[model samples]
Target chain A: MSLTPSKRAYVPFVSVEHMMGLVHHIGIEQVLTDLASEIEADFRRWPLFDKTPRVASHSDVGVIELMPTSDGETYGFKYVNGHPKNTAEGLQTVTAFGLLAEVDSGYPTLLSEMTLLTALRTAATSAMAAKHLAPKGARTMAMIGNGAQSEFQCLAFKAVCGIDTVRLYDIDTSATTRCAGNLAANGLTVVECRSGQEAMEGAQIITTCTADKQYATILTDNMVGSGVHINAIGGDCPGKTELHRDILLRSSIFVEYPPQTRVEGEIQQLEHDHAVTELWKVIEGQVSGRTDDRQITLFDSVGFAIEDFSALRYIAKAVKGTPFFTELDMIADPDDPRDLFGMFQRAKS
Target chain B: MSLTPSKRAYVPFVSVEHMMGLVHHIGIEQVLTDLASEIEADFRRWPLFDKTPRVASHSDVGVIELMPTSDGETYGFKYVNGHPKNTAEGLQTVTAFGLLAEVDSGYPTLLSEMTLLTALRTAATSAMAAKHLAPKGARTMAMIGNGAQSEFQCLAFKAVCGIDTVRLYDIDTSATTRCAGNLAANGLTVVECRSGQEAMEGAQIITTCTADKQYATILTDNMVGSGVHINAIGGDCPGKTELHRDILLRSSIFVEYPPQTRVEGEIQQLEHDHAVTELWKVIEGQVSGRTDDRQITLFDSVGFAIEDFSALRYIAKAVKGTPFFTELDMIADPDDPRDLFGMFQRAKS
Candidate 1:
């Protein structure tokens, strides 16, 4: 209607720099704590949200996926790609961006770089699940596969689940050193371990987040003890898993969404009919979590659209009155809605 | 590892203003002509594309959809929303944006405003189909339902299909007047007709593109005569159709991706097993188009992803060395690919 775009035509876009600024504005530990609460709140009302398994296009080298969800009022989707070989080319193995729109008008409200947001959400989700499923009074976590996601997981655990120490291990020792260095000022006692077994020593929460496109065991059945929680993050696509099948057999498996988790999570190693609990049910208090001290609980985390929805929702609220986003003239708005051609013609002059 | 992001982290973003600048720079008619050729080229090599029905999330008022496709070398996807009621609230009925990326590294290379692009592509597709199917010596087009897309369609037919006259008609005379006014300087005979019957007089090509989210027959069986090519545009999505079922039964229906058209195009009114020719085959010469002057050829046009892909491909090339796009730091690139956490941590300093 106006010569310049109306307010509705502009979508708030948080770029990589803006996302980094937002993370620092809200401290990383605080963001993790807030994101966990947001995720938990959404999980409690999971039935109201439209959930679908991410649509993925797989290539020989990697896969690109679209994860979408709507809670009736707001709709959200994330465009993410996972290329395991990308790291070798000096590129991120996983890079993502997302959009949030008003469900009523179907107008986008926010577009954001989700690479950093994803790292925070994934860690927050693992921490939130551990909070409900891990052994009581757990103060130490074994973070195996110390790659890009290692420090975030360590900080999230400290903020959300009260873990005071993180024992880190990676096949590449330099990765472990880098992760340890990143967490040095974060107030957590970081232990650089030589092997996965060494990392697990006295740690009640063990997280497996290795980056490989094959069935590789980061954790074996013999290494997992009773009264512990296994936060499995790397076993995310079919043919890519971290824990041995025997370890899964020994633990009670919990997943984000069964239909998707069965295909992409660590539980892919088990039968389709294998008994597993949906984590939302536990978070909603409809099912028991860690009922006894000696029980082995495993949150087979492949991530889900709802968690991203929660992250977007959280960022949308957090960016209000903040210099963390720029307005993008993404939507075309003609003064008369039926006069787009006229608008184009006028633009020529 | 470098402290600043590399060239790979920046994605070129074409905003609405930039898109308009591009269209005017290229000349709307030239852009339409180029788009038609691009779409035709993609159609000729359609088998090389990974095609699938767009994933849509429909609400009571409108729908949000993601259309994704990949040629082994490159990947593209569009995020579009259609809200018919939005116009009443001073919003465009449809708004869109799309992205293109390298299939190898799974990194986004371009992000562009596709609302204007979609309009151009849709018109180009219609004109492209008409060029292959319209009867010989067709110089006049009956452009029914003069709305946002009317002028674009008329110009495209002129540029690509050699139609010199567009007879426009709409239920709202203001729309017809506006459309005719916009095309006055475009060097075509703009006939603002009073009724649908008046618009079709001596017209060899009839395009019905009305925007109502219901089955309203803008063209009935009795109204459409023989030897005319019907470009049905508004019969997109389920519960929407612009032509009568009787008309579909009488015409030789040609569609882009039968799997999708059968559910969303004018052919949706016909039986699922009803015979229809895939348009790609016709373009590739495997199937004949307009065998005789008396034969009715219907291009059951529901926009497809490959057309959008072709549009993105065209813009990706067209925007080269042009000031029509801005680079957005949409992706996170750590110099050391495995040090994303360190990158985030350093941003604090």
Candidate 2:
């Protein structure tokens, strides 16, 4: 018997190599811009989504979480891990993959490596939030953590928020050097700074994405200034925070999902009932993002499932008729649905 | 500039074809027997496992679920869907896949097609329960539903419980014919019955595996006699049941997980706090299974994540150095963990 799989048996898989090729093929800047647009569009329809806090399995070393969401037609989920100690052992601190399935049949349509796509989407989401909340005519961004995510954040800001310069700082100077070297040829003017305060000087947008498992303040209250947008990316899990509580007190905070952000974001340090604005509300015009120039706006982003869903949707669209993905025979398609045993028996020959 | 993946970058994937080959390579009867042993061992250490009720997304037509469990050393999850109406549309009513990851680093170790493996494990689990709870010298099993799972159940019982005869009955006589034809070459003596009553004649074990999304009475109260172990497999989802309530009221109920079985198993028809014995307790010697010969025992099998975890562990061990599985380049392992952007840039060549 010929083993040609039917359409339902195959799922398109975008590997790490293909995902990188896709980013380069579409031009990383364009991918980020398009992802930002898609995320913004999804946020506009937030009410239609089935949202829940990610299902997490915590271990002594790190956490692995499954973030799932559906918009009535498509269902998406991301399996992500965060082990801060992995980097010291020559492994990624965060690696991820995701799937998009048809809700009608509950069959997966796409399975893609989300490690690279996650960086792209995180940068896009941060830049998109900055575009809505940053000071008018923002031209410079201070990236405090010069880590794996630094270069993507710089480029995303350059593409989506129109920033042309980035000031980089990290306690480990080699990280700042690496970040500056990557951005040197990417059409952005890069400045390596001696300290976080130096990086924050004259910057209209500050992005803190430090990697730490504890509640160490990467940015003190004195470092942040008025009229700037602060993008807090790290401090995603419990006991991890980057910004000072005083800084959070002064800023008008925005979050992806309140139930999740309250548990995993910088706001986890504050009272449970701390007031904050939902980003979707701002995108939907139900709430204002930045009403005054001098008001400090903070996007406390603990990544949500819907953003991953949006990124999966974007990849599913971008890979159509392209050679960036291969079909994986993932589902079992017996010729007779009730004769799976017979299918197994026949395969013996 | 070589693109060869590092050691940690690859995850082993067993496709449906590879899974079928693996089963044949190991001998199907041996696989089922070994799976039963593995599941029984896991059940003995059930308190060490981290368990949660499966997260399910229900629709009008079917339901999809994510079942996850961890034993501190390893973590596993299965993505499964059930749509009873699918067979009429030329699709399998159920399909599944699963992953096992390292708990320390949260890296996936294996990805396998679990639709075939799920059938194997479910049969193994049912037979394992029957071995402990069935009447001594049980030779004949009345399998009321002749569908996809019927053959595996028949084989598992023969291999694990020493059953030599299987009497089959189905609402559709063609189903019964197909089932009997498949088992004709096997060692068991197959008998086709015109009604449920004929199938139960002289049978020490009664297995109801019908498929429907309604309150089905495949075995009425008058049909089920005393001292027969009823393996209830098809009443796995809410509003979908096989045996009548009268049958449940008289039988001593056993379940995998009380929280899940209460909501998805035949026990769902009972009260919220209905008394039921956990199967693991029996395996651990903390509770008795069959204390007398004339008492009816029912195994309310709703399927649990730990069973999938055990099956995954068995596959991960069985496929070692074998050609039955292939390696997949799933994880992105950049030489410098902090230089993900640089990795993408270097991959451009």
Candidate 3:
């Protein structure tokens, strides 16, 4: 039977540039601040999530991953690729996009680029951990990996935890120079450190976002002082790590989804029973965070799907007033659900 | 450090019509034949592949699914949705797309629409199963549920089996008329039948593809005669069944992935040890398909990822020599795998 002529179809989409414009339009400071709050809020209600470790398809050159998580009512997943050797071939090592769909109908509500969103969430997650686990009155941060993620980290700390200065260091001097140029003398007292050791000195928060797809000790125990909160961002897959073993042992480590962290985050080198605290437990008052001010603390940040969920949720809200977004023909909208084949003739494209 | 000049930026996407046009240009008959060969080849080496039950996300009105499979060097996943009630609202009951990527790089090499491809593969899979299972010299066929896929079923049988005529029936008379008209003046003889019983008279191959998403006894024991080959296609999800318990009891059952078939196929109504054979065994010559000419053979067909993989593989070959296709920006071309952010600025989307 022919489908009725009157029908409605929706193509909901948000492009990369439109999403970035929305971030700028709403002020990055406010965005990061709110993002941390959303992450923290979602984490506190952690029991609501159906948590499964990400399903990863690893390769010799890199890894492509699908991270799916649901809070029973909403389902979300991110399709991301991490190819460390891509930069040599003029490609970005990490590129991502994700979808947020309704659990009841499985209809995609928002499909958007997550490359920029990922940067925002990583920074937000780091700051969210710092807020619960870092010592009060922490004012400075040591950004060890001054690459694409540096600007977002600097801004996240500034907007969320009142950090006013950042000391940056990278193996490439050009990366450090470029990071500083993007900062453009904006508020934070930028110090271009010659080494990771130099960057960690006299810092309250140490954030590492290095991109090597190998086991790298970006921070050794000697470089990290007592009471410093290490926000280890890189070393996010198997056969990759950032902080040295001794550093992890000494600090009271707090992590997001410990099971996943043990495989992809800095804690991968440690034992299964190596006592660690979940950040959500502390945020929800289920467990204590930063029990002693002088105690060294660490946030083993392996990116989680929920943070991306929160990031997508935040973007949908922040970009509400903008007309920069365009829709993609992702879902089939037919005149009659039973007659799917009729769709081909109705929508020729 | 600006990534403004990175050479790893690309956005090549083939639209929906281009894919269909490519399929049409390649000729439908060739795709079916090549797909049959691919399915047969994959089924033979079934043990080498890592197979898992499909992960389904069900909803009130439909289900969105991700069927993932890999063979060490390549990874493929299909995103498909089945909404039987969608046509009432002018939406497709099913819409699908999938990706094929290199296992070494986790980079997607091909991204193609699977809505049409699915129709082709489903029919090809049925015919492939019938080749080994159906009794000798099966000519006339009874096709239950004449919808969009009716034409493919008729053609695949004519090509794979030596079927000379089709006896069709549908609850909706218009659908039956459409099927008859499409088959008219095209090689095979077409006849309209008043009921499922009427369609099965003298027909050796009885295909049941009714769209009711529930337990339906479309084929009763009395209607299913000796030497009848039942191709049950529509009973593909949980709570969906087509054959009566008695029909299944008297017939020899065959399936694709027993674990999944237990939940989604016609055997969902049967006991755990109902004694079904995997189609791979038959294709590989490891097991006997049909023992006697008078024995009732039933193929409880639930489409699998490998079949989709076979179809996608076949399509890639079919379009290899033609310039009728375009590529999607499914993967990034980064000079430095770490500089994914810089490529966004250069994407020219």
Candidate 4:
């Protein structure tokens, strides 16, 4: 018997190196623009996908989550972890990887390192939401929390929403300086501010992407003005909200999946029975987005599985015939599928 | 800056070829025996694990499941899929991979192909349960379905429980012939039987591991004699079972995790409130295993997450300092955790 693995036994793997190469080859801004459109398209047909709240295993120091979804023809899931303390040890606060499989054979088609992909997708998702909810003619964004995700968010908004300027702030000035330096050559006018209040000046959009696992308020009610869209992406776990209660009550809230947002999003700060529109409904034109120019629209942005699914789907296509992936013998396929032991015995030779 | 991945950025990956090499180097019987011991040790301290039913995505053609568990220090999860139609397409009916991460940092430390490891662990878990539940001096086991898992089950029982003989039978004579051939020189007295009743004639233990996604009786109630230990492993999904309902009623049933078993095991044929002993409880001495020699005992084995976790822990140790794994740059680690965008820019050269 031939010992070479069959095509069925190989899965295409995109490592961090390959992902970076793919991103740069496709151009980050172009990739982000395409990802936003792909996410918007998936959101348009959201009801066709199977949606469930992520399965999370929370520890005292961190949390690990598995977010899975399928669109009838394909299945996808992402394994991600959030450990705020990891940065102190020179590691990322979040790391991730994901898989895509064919629903027909239950075989994996793609496995990719999702740390970089997640960064791209999360920013694309934020920019996509803002495109629908942010006030028309909005060209400036207040980016509070100039940490790892700041530059990506700034660039995605520039690419997807036509925002040309970003006002950046963080509790640590070093992070703000780092963010400002990264955007210097990206064509975005970046202003580094000392405080959260200073970051909001002359900005039509507010994006909060802090990393504290607490209830500290990054945006008080008085700081958020009317007619600006708020993308609260940091308050993703219970007891870690970013917006104040008053700001939540005043805003017209929208969320990805209500069952998950009620537990993990900024809406968790609101009453359990508070009204929130599903983002897909608005994207599909079944519900209105930004009904009035002066309306306070809050996209309570806790990440969802479908967004990762969209990213997986996009990467699976984008890497085709490109030198952005290598094959791994991750699956075992015997000539006679039922004789797995015979295959094992033959390998003993 | 060095382009080489830092230690934290690398995760050890065990592929199919490496897994086979490791198994052959360590000997399959030794690996099975070691896996059984590891499973037992974990079952002895089962309460420390954070357990949940597998998150399953069911499609018309198949099911994909994520099984996750943590023991405070480490977290592990397995991604497995079952598509019976896959065999017809010259693919394995089941395929799997797993990950292990440190709970403190939530960083994935290991990624291993589990399609083969899963078969090993399942048999090990079965043999471990039979060691506690099987009658004293049980020398012969009737392996009713000679599929991919049959040889592993036979060898595991031989190594862990000292069963010197296995009676094999399958509806397909070729399968039975193949199974007998595989076990020929394995130090077991292999008997080829024409029927399930003939296989059970002189056996005190019976293991059923068929692969049909339906409710079909491979063993009738009248065929099962008193005082025999039954390992029912084939009835793993909803609407799939092997034994007659009357046989399940006559046996003193034990299960891995009741919540999962009630939905996916032979006990699904029974009432939702049926009393069944947990195998871990028996291993922990919190409950009894087999009360008398004349009382039928059934291990209704629907696999659980902790078993996979135990196997992961085992492989993580076994592959250390060995040529069984390769490091993949799966995690993106920047020099400064907050300077991820800077890392991207630096990689451009």
Each candidate's lDDT (Cα)? Answer: 0.93, 0.93, 0.77, 0.93
Q: For residues A1-349, what per-residue lDDT tens digits would candidate 2 score against the true structure?
A: 5566578999899999999998899999999999999999999999999998999999989998999999989889999999999999999999888999888788889998998889999999999999999999999999999999999999999999999989999999999998998888899989999999999998999999998988999999988888989999998998999999999999999999999999999999999999999999999999999999889999999999999999999999999999999988888888788988998888888
True contacts kept of each: 0.84, 0.72, 0.36, 0.81
Q: How well is candidate 1 docked (DockQ)?
A: 0.88
lDDT by residue (tens digit), candidate 2, B34-107: 99999999999999999999988888888888899999999999999898888988888899999999989988
State the lDDT of candidate 3 residue by residue for B161-187, as single tens digits. 889999999988988887787677558
What's the lDDT for residue B189 in model 2? 98
**Residue range A1-349, candidate 3, lDDT tens digits:** 4333322234355665566566667767787888999988899789898677777767678887777777767778777778777666555567777777766555567767777778888998898889888889999898888777788888899889999889889999888877776666468888898998888778988898998899998887788778878888897899899888998889898888888998888888899889998888899998888888688888888899899888887776666657857654444444444344444433433
**Model 2 global lDDT (CA atoms, 0 to 1):** 0.93
Clashes of 4: 0
What is each model's TM-score for chain A? 0.99, 0.99, 0.95, 0.99
Which digits, one per residue and each the tens of the lDDT, describe model 1 over residues A301-324?
998999999999999999999999
- Clashing residue pairs in candidate 4 are none
Flag regions of model 1 displaced more than 4 Å: none
Residue-by-residue lDDT tens digits, candidate 4, A1-349: 8878789899999999999999999999999999999999999999999989999999887899999999999999999999989888999999999999998888999999999999999999999999999999899999999889989999999999999989999999999998999899999988888889999998999999999888879999999888889999999998899999999888899999999999999888777999999999999999998999789999998899999999999999999989999999999888888888888888888
Q: Report DockQ per prediction, comma-separated.
A: 0.88, 0.83, 0.38, 0.86
- Which pairs, if any, clash in model 1? A1-A334, A1-A335
Which portion of correct inter-chain contacts appears in model 4?
A: 0.81
Model 3 TM-score, 2 decimals: 0.88
Of the pair 1 and 3, which is ahead by lDDT?
A: 1
